[model samples]
Target: MNLATNVRIVLVEPAGALNVGAIARVMKNMGLYQLVLVNPQCDPLGEEARRMAVHGGEVLEGATRFENLPEALEGCQRAIATTARDRHVPLTLETPKQVLPWCLEGSPTALIFGPEYRGLSNQELNYAQRFLGIPSNPEYPSLNLAQAVAVCVYELYQLSQNNLAVPPQTTEAARLEDIEGYYQHLESTLLKIGYLQPHTATARMAKFRRLYNRASLSHDEVALLRGILRQVEWAIKPQAGDAE
Candidate 1:
């Protein structure tokens, strides 16, 4: 299988048909095909989008749609979300060149972009394992949605052509969906144990996410961790024989 096909370009709540069409055209130009739209604000197949797509119409037509970011990234092992916002907790923001290569290492990966106007919120950003911030002039740092797609697509295309030095995969990384399940299991357990208060759970979970993302846990690795959590829950539960 062409590893290039493993990379998905996911647009979250994109607003402009023209921009979506243009993004399709650029993906075709760079030999990338997977385009995923999450709750798009405009019809990707509308006239405006079609008009901009020109010869790249097929890419636009073949685009898949999802209700949310997590669904769009269901099978992905790694994901990077694009954002210009600064977080209070401070996630390390790397340029596209620095982080984009991580996706090309053979497992399914996603490059996420937020809406045109407001960008991604912290909650939405939580779904990604990494964050991308394209370098631009401080005077006007924002890039048009299509322009941003083009820049990232070009970088990926160049790396793919150069045969980026990716080590052969020996173990499968935990799919984002599985990792998310573990996170949920972990959070619930933590709450039951009084380790996490309701108001503080979200913030504390973000730190856990960062820690796990950095570890790049494999499928079995995550399973083992979750197994431990389940055992902990079992051990802590009140025995029926002991209840007064």
Candidate 2:
């Protein structure tokens, strides 16, 4: 569970010094150090943040500031945005428990937190490939910014510590290339059978892609799907007599 260096915590327009400091302390406790601030409203080095940071002062001082969320996440390949409220934006929301595996998959990842008062805007959330929703009492579902980070980071830490043996990295998950090919085959097959209209094809395909992507289908699964598409295509095409 050597995740100490793989994750960057990004705070967007944090207004409370105490929360920033507290988050630094938690980050230190969890053995994580990379912190990025986007348009912070308070001096991250102010007394309140430092006081809470205490032994984690180094993490706070070394934190980088950014003008916006995208700048902070420039080189990051994977990002998970935390939100308590539901939005109509098309995103695959997963619980922290479900997202931990992907976060621990040895890639440079970022965990984004939005403004203290409003949380992440819909536009800001779009930068993330996935959304994480922490399970809290529905009666009072809101979580403090620092607290949300603590929960997500801790779950990640625990998953790392468990160290379950994963399949070999050589057996990579299905790539976007293969996924796209499969999508093309599927849509063409569906259209041939009059299941998808030309006018609605794009929107329907987008939703299907999201569903397939969330499963994180492996190479074998993708192959199996492609085979199914081939069979359907062969069966549906007009034969010589049928066409006449």
Candidate 3:
């Protein structure tokens, strides 16, 4: 039903040309097109990549490159990133079947995969509102980059092509930048009010990010929160002299 057009697959710091090429091929097979590479270590158009891409050469050649994850995700309203390992902090890692449908609910959505050696770092993972991990044999749990792409794309393509009931987006989801702005404003306002100490702010803010992400706040909700932060700043500025 032409649903795959809005989906984007992002590869972070991919270093293997073959993996890049194969990923392109699989994406095309699954009727998915958009591909973004963040600080890739290999040329996606190289011979090895092209050889692997074969029929999907167009996808590989058309892939966009970015210096960082946030840059790669600029316009995405919904995103799910993959991580192989567990985190020290609390996070729900869903199976592909469980999270793939979320990709269809928003315009310009994203599914991110980390490099071959290591999956996404905690900082990089924070950018994504959701996280996924494919269930595999625990004794040899890791999957190669191309394989991971293939698996997720296949499942997503099926969900997209079939008229499966993905819950209609009731409210326009806030863009990534909008959510990020709220986080920044929230942090600064909290610090100004002595509610967030500098030493513990990063960790505390992460928990907040996770909380709000799960809420999947709409654009208006984000605006309302930001307005609260602004008013708080205005109310507290007069008491600035008391802090010292």
Number of the predicted model whose TM-score against the real structure is largest: 1
Which regions of candidate 2 fall more than 4 Å away from where they truly are? 165-244
Q: Which digits, one per residue and each the tens of the lDDT, describe model 1 over residues 1-244?
A: 2544789999999999999999999999998889999999999999999999988899998999999898999989999989887767578899988998887788899999999999888998888888899999999999999999999999888888888837747898999999999999999999999999999999999999989988889999999999999999999999889957
TM-score versus the correct structure, for each prediction: 0.97, 0.70, 0.94
lDDT of 3 by residue, 195-225 (tens): 9999999999999999999999899999999
* Ranking according to TM-score, highest score first: 1, 3, 2
Error of 1 at 163 (Å): 1.4
- State the C-alpha lDDT per candidate: 0.91, 0.82, 0.88
* lDDT of predicted model 2: 0.82
Compare the candidates by lDDT and give the number of the best one: 1
**Candidate 3 at 101: error in angstroms?**
1.0
lDDT of 3: 0.88
lDDT of 2 by residue, 43-159 (tens): 899999999999999999999998987678866656778887876667767898887687777656789999889999976765566789988899999999999999987887787
